[model samples]
Target: MLDRSRTREGHSPAEALRDTVEFARRAEALGYHRFWVSEHHGVPGVAGSAPTVLAAAVAAATSRIRVGTGGVMLPNHRPLVVAEQFGVLESLFPGRIDMGLGRSVGFTGPVRRALGHDKDDADRFEGQLAELLGYFTGANEVPGLPAEGLRVPAFVLATGAGAGIAARHGLPLVIGAVRGEEPMLRAVRDYRAEFRPSPLAAEPYVVVSLSVAVAATAEEAWRLLVPEAWAMAHSRTRGVFPPLRPAAEVLALPMTARERSLFEQSLRGHLFGTPAEIAESLDALVARTGADEVLVTTSTHDRAALLDSYRLLADAAGGR
Candidate 1:
């Protein structure tokens, strides 16, 4: 499961962090294979700005369930710094750390400027990713500390262009099912066909990350997904991803027709239903994408409802 520790309207950031750690422990107990955190710089809706730091807290909180970055945006920081950070993580957690890298820059121009990244930085992701990976083996050594033989397994947060990079490096690809089914499947197909085996991976591997929620009733599950959807829609229209409002409040909000259209479009990327319905959709999605594993990334305004959604999902996934 992946949690951005999204800031809810009434809850403080500290509470979000606490909820994240608690959620991680519960996920471990529920037999989840891995728990990951995301990085969203300068977004009011997201509290997980430093994924590695949050991941460390998660690792310390749980004995199982591999912890990782849903991704560290490569363009935001130097490869050497990332190497040292993940090196420290691997050193502490040993075999339980994951180095998931992404190509995105900050969401807006000001944020990108703050990170000292240019507009063209997005084009340099492949190079940055290579440098970061090389740091793990000291292949393209960057002096200072020797990170020559560290073993923090790396995964690429595959998107349109990132899929090629992941294939070229032979790292496992973690693609989101939210990107539309056909496009995601095509990306996977291209990734597998072009894959070149390396020491890191013997063959192509795919992990399909899904925005999913489950409950006893389909209506309740859909309600749980509304807060995040509204948050996303608000971000698109307002240019600021504010903290999530209550689902009821979100539903009652007066929006322009265009904003309403965008809201429904955002909701299309997510899956929410009764456990059986979710399981069936998940199975079909997995089969179509040929995903080696599925990563569940879910969030909601209500912590109790969020936890219940995960519990229901766990039961459906046969993790319980």
Candidate 2:
């Protein structure tokens, strides 16, 4: 998981970049497979505005673990530029770069405008994704296109019809499973059914990213998750970015019983508990989804607590 909160809380962008590099290095040392950084614009609680830049830093800082965007919102940028960025990253990192592209703008109108994108941008995301893959695969070299000879391992971040596009292109698919399992399972099925062999990936590969907070006790973990839960609740109701508040403050805020129940249910699929318990839960989740990989996103205000959560998760995954 990426440390979005570090950049959100008084740390400069440079500091957040350096911290991410160090974090990736530590994750590699601890035997984690890949370190993914998310993309969020105009959100004070998330500093990963430029995922590719941070990905390059993490790639340079670590020798083993793969580094990439948990996703880059494809509609916001030119596909060729995206291709070149990942191409350059691949050139630098060789075998350890992943390009996960998402269709969502990840923001509302104002932030999207600030990012130089409009609402119609999302409509073109599918076509742009196709163009991106074409560029990477040397298919867009008819007359005057920037991408003639470039190819990298690309995965699409699918929440809906994007899954079908991933299948058509034969790209690996990563589903954001924060909402529920049904959408994810359907996407997985669609991706697998429509998958066609490609140079980058011949078989279907599915990865799921979800909220996770593990502690010595379930109660402690639940407490740590209050910030995230509250964030979700606020996002659902208010539709704005709120500063990361204390968990006590979160709990103290007025909440209907139904709202509280929704938050609890939202937290259910997450891997939380002691090492052994997490491992068992993780194994079951993987089994249920047949996912090749799982990305854990922990919502914590304390950096130490966040690191400890990842360490415990790594241990649960049978890593030292």
Q: In terms of TM-score, which candidate is strongest?
A: 1
- Residue-by-residue lDDT tens digits, candidate 2, 54-104: 888788788888888878899889888888888788877877888888888
What is candidate 1's local distance difference test score? Answer: 0.87
Q: What residue pairs clash in candidate 2, if any at all?
A: none
lDDT, model 2: 0.76
Per-model C-alpha lDDT, please?
0.87, 0.76
lDDT of 2 at 74: 91
Over 4 Å off, model 2: 2-17, 142-150, 254-266
Q: Model 1, 292: alpha-carbon shift in Å?
A: 0.6
Error of 2 at 231 (Å): 1.8
TM-score of each: 0.96, 0.89
Q: Candidate 1 residues 1-320, lDDT tens each?
A: 88889999988888888888999999999888889998988888888998989999999998868999989988888899899898888888888999889888889999989998877898888888888888877677365153558877899997779899999998999998556788888899999999999889999999988889888898898888888888888888899998888899999989999889988887887788998999898888777877889888887888888898998888888942
